[model samples]
Target: MNNSVFRRLLLPGVIVLAGCSGSTDPETAHLFDNVKNLNNGEYDRQIASKDAEAAAIVRQNNAASARISTLRNQSASNSAEIKALTSQISSLRAQTSSLRGKFSNQPDKLAQLNQLDGQLVQIRADVGAGTSPSVARAELNRVSAAIRALSR
Candidate 1:
């Protein structure tokens, strides 16, 4: 398709070059043709090199576009996994919290209580998507300190 369009456009250019062909006086015709051929050959070489460079650029761009598409798909998968894990943590937190008051009834109550995990999960949800896991660690530290103070 591109080749046909280029050839169609090239016809007018060929016509323009031919229009400049030949001198009315016989003496200069040979000189004119020689000079024209030299110039035309040089122009053709330049156009060929330019076309090769353009093709290289197109290939690089196409490869880059494909890479961008792959990265986008990976990002989507990572995002989905993060969401699923977040939901799972949330459900786990809900379950553990439901057992909060029941800890007093258990014989080994202190060993069974996992308040820090519930607090970390709640912190992650509050900070929202894209937050680093470190944020949850900070919440764990806070919860641990609070729990320690209460024990004393």
Candidate 2:
């Protein structure tokens, strides 16, 4: 009788302990997967690649922005330089024309003007944007000035 009673007590305790012990299987209420069961290495690598790509994109954008700012500064300086050089070139040409009334070599003055024009074109191109808008405007103005100089 005592053995029967002890068995009855032990059976309920064992059942209660089993119920209290948490099961390894995840509950249905949870949404994301458990980190431990990440079996597929490919999926992990893909996720990391996506994250790295996103970070690289942001870094690229930041680098582009910095480049744009540098271009803008160069553009502004070039614009000023173009204005000064244009004024100087005009003066030099006028003086050369006066001198040509006495001398014979017209090719020399023309060659000098052409060389300066090339420099001006290059400056304009550099001022133009790889990514920046502010620099593009500066570059365009200088380019227009250079074009006008050439047309003359």
Candidate 3:
């Protein structure tokens, strides 16, 4: 009976002591570092993917910004052209009015002045109707030539 009890107790104590032995082997310690490095590698890949996506978004935003700047520049240019055209039209109308008074006494001169006035009115209407700046400028130049000829 004493031998049986001693055997049972000793067997259980040996098992407990063996399990408690410290794991000091180099291979066992390096296993933990290997697992940590693998997890770090996966984290690095995820970071790279996110950075690439963010860079693509930034590129798209830059393109959009450039397009917006181009549109604004075009709008400003159009506005300036319209303003200049309006000024030219006003000046031409004044010249026509002045010529009309000067030529009222002569029938031939009056008819030429009337024709020049008609051309001015037509060009004004074309400009108001959104004619391109080049076309409107060409027509204004033609009218100005006529007015100069009539004055002579």
Runs in model 2 with CA error above 4 Å? Answer: 1-51, 94-152
Candidate 1 vs. true structure, TM-score: 0.52
Better of 1 and 3 by TM-score: 3
**Per-model C-alpha RMSD:** 13.4, 11.6, 10.8
Native-vs-model 2 lDDT?
0.57
lDDT of 3 by residue, 60-146 (tens): 999999999999999899889988988998898899899888888989988887887888788878878889999999988988888
Residue 16, model 1: lDDT of 69
Task: Report lDDT (CA) for all predictions.
Answer: 0.63, 0.57, 0.81
Best by TM-score: 3
Inter-residue clash pairs, candidate 3: none
Instruction: Write down the TM-score of every candidate.
Output: 0.52, 0.34, 0.65
Q: Pick the candidate with the highest lDDT.
A: 3
Across 1-152, the per-residue lDDT of candidate 1 in tens digits comes to 99999999999877766667654333554554556656667546756788999999999999999999999998897677567556655654565566566665664544444655556566666546566555544654566565445344
In model 2, residue pairs whose N, Cα or C atoms come closer than 3 Å (at least 3 residues apart or on different chains), thus clashing, are none
Poorest 10 consecutive residues of model 3 by lDDT? 21-30
Per candidate, the number of residue pairs that clash is 0, 0, 0
Two-way lDDT contest, 2 vs 3, winner: 3
